[model samples]
Target chain A: MASNAGVAQSRALPGPVRFITSSIGAKVVMAVSGFVLVGFVLVHMIGNLQIFLGPEAINRYGNFLQGLGELLWVFRLGLLAALIAHVASAARLVILNQSARPINYSHNDYVQVKFAARTMPISGIVVLAFIIFHLAHFTGGKVQPELFHFQDELGQHDIYAMVTLGFQNWFISGFYIVANALLALHLSHGVSSMFQTLGVTAPAWRPLTHALGPVIGTIIFIGNVGIPLACSLGLVAIPAGAM
Target chain B: MHLTLHVWRQKSANDKGRLVQYEVDNISSDMSFLEMLDVFNESLIAKGEEPVAFDHDCREGICGACSLVINGIPHGPDEGTTVCQLHMRRFKDGDTIYIEPWRAKAFPVIRDLIVDRTAFDRIQQAGGFITINTGGAPDANALPIAKTEADLAMDAAACIGCGACVAACPNASAMLFVGAKVSQFLHLPQGHPERARRVKAMVEQMDAEGFGNCTNHYECMAACPKEIDVRVIAELNLEFMKAKISGRE
Candidate 1:
């Protein structure tokens, strides 16, 4: 028995390396990367809310971000890495889950699983698509050249004009609203699930962790949609000379 | 009660299975689900037809031998009860019921309604024991255990090894079963000697068995005939993390 134990130990992979290849390890990666992305979304939403402060404040905020130059690229690259890890882990889990049930049941019942949990893969894909479209529209200036490349009087990129004009278009605003709603649905399940996967929620605090998902998701949804809705309704408009 | 059952019929593990319908009349409402199957089997014998094969033992819930996904829900529509304990009264007269085997890649169908659950036995064999010196039985009072801890351990130990959790889970994960076994030992003082090794081995075995990962769907808890809580899965995660971290040192 002692010899066998030694043999097993010698044959086993190193702890950290084995963990990355294990099922739980993949889930942990998903949870951690999900946290990073969630943080980025919240910060981005808060920064966008600065548009309510008018052209100077919002454009200056954009200029400040661009001012960082290489530092900004580093941040973007970090975010890109997180996004790739999150999506890769998610896709792998999906494939494994599908293979787990080789035979399909004619009738299957779900008791405690919610709609958001059931449609996670779909909602995740939708959010990914929205992210790509958003970057192309705002950052790349490829989607709408006329509105995206405008400059304010001070010669900074007119972020305020771009945002207000984009939201004023019903199609852009509607798409933003719909995509944000889907993101909320995805986050509602993802957030609580991450807590469970990380094993941070003890039995005593399980209820709180479960409720955290919807609460955070709702806050983000409202914060993001508020900007677009306000812009479309003429509540927040571009400054007189900023365009 | 007269009922129609669309039972899954398979010749062997290598053969294709199909839902074959059968009619059983005059089933007593007081008859347990297995008893109903017995009556149907007797009718098949009388007709010289091949009777539907299923796994059952003790005709009681404790054995965890009887497994059936009745009407899409594991162990029929009844909660916290196995098929052997589920009475026919739970069904309406002339109702059509769908019955299928526990479906998972780790649990392949051996025959009708019987999957090779030896995968579970292999997982248990990996680390589900303590390597204590052989001796006489210890006194009941030899190890003093707190009531709360003992109760929680017993609760987790109550798992009967039924694969309903796998059938009910969309991901077909076995975290609940593995969690229950790990928690049963983790909460006990006697189980501490090999805690890290046990958790690591069992989890590795579980992964090697081709079971899917848990995504916190909570369906396993709902479908469990023994009502094992998913909180045990959290405990399993904790134990695994501890093992991985401590093993590095």
Candidate 2:
């Protein structure tokens, strides 16, 4: 077990992954990749918000993205690689911790750790699934027909219109809102924490994290949620009977 | 005041352990928590029952030896106070207090309320000290240190090496403990000579000792007897990274 102050006793067990996951070296890699992913998420959310410009604006945005074609695919693939690495490392660490204590502990009754730390995995998985569904329905064009009913003034199906319409549904909007809230919480801790994990959080840099973490999180949340808000408000035209 | 006690009673390290309930009557609210424990132990000795063997040396709270998981807290519920200094007034009369040893795989139970904390010593041995011979004693202020730097170092040094941070951590991570030690040395000139080596060796030792990786829970700081901040852990991480990049062995 890693020696901690006060805890003279430790039950940490050894494994190859355990060593890697616990080391300062590997944690740096995780932190760097996680930060990269946060950047990517911010950029992606910004791109998604172009739907607020209406069908022509939104489709043109998609076409411009499709304009890059292979380059965009490259970016997607890179993001996928980073996401996989982050998730894999986190899973490995979680599993190692679970195994370290073979027996179920009858711990003291009060909860000690922060709710964010305790719920990271569960929240991560939820956000992961949300992202997959979001990509499939909005970006991948795999489920385009479902959203095609929301044609714009140009007689083109506006993805932005579909987004606003999507949020009009209370159930869908509620899920989106909840997921975005969780996303903000995740980003708030994740961004600041990644810097520390990378060992870059000096006294000078510490204040930056405290300020930037919440700011970046708020911006992404606003950008992502803005689409549904516009749709629900009828600022964008959704075709009759569009879900 | 009366308090219900749920104490861990084990015959030995190898015995099956369980919590046995008891009550201590007319306990004074001003009494430090450990003093109350002393009273209970006296009762146990009178009954010919084995007294709960806990590790404590300096009741004044600087020894870093008084470790207990009280009411699911590392050192009772108060922030920035050791178990030895935790007063009964924080707890209400008739409060049910559950106490146990710090639970970690590496920290095996030696007896009731005591565990083998030698793992910390082993990690320290790995490289907590600066290999320097400044002679018996240097001038009181021979080397200059910035007031801010000195204060920060002292703040980190305030970490009594009490294991409350580890016990408070869900994953039982030792990052705070190692980080505080690393930061204290890194903050001063004397520590500069062995900075890189110290970080690398201590972190390697910490990992080898089988502690879980920190996930930024910050519970360690919350439960810290000295309220040692998590920033020290951040400093330690910074030191560790620089050491690795600079190829310090």
Chain A TM-score compared with the true chain A, each model in order = 0.91, 0.77
Each prediction's whole-model lDDT (CA): 0.89, 0.76
Query: What is candidate 1's CAPRI-style docking category based on DockQ?
Result: medium
Model 1: how far is B76 from its true place, Å?
1.2
The 10-residue segment with the lowest total lDDT in model 2 chain B: B240-249
Off by over 4 Å in 1: A1-15, A239-243
The TM-score of candidate 2 is 0.87
**Model 1 per-residue lDDT tens digits across residues B1-249:** 899999999999999999999999989999999999999999999999999999999877999999999999889888898999999999889999999999999899999999989878888998988789989999999999999899899999999999899888999999999999999998889899899999888887877788888988999999899999888888888788888888832
iRMSD computed for candidate 2: 5.4
Give the backbone clash total of model 2: 20
lDDT of 1 by residue, A46-143 (tens): 99889988889999999999999999999999999999999998998899999989898987877788999989999999899999999999999887
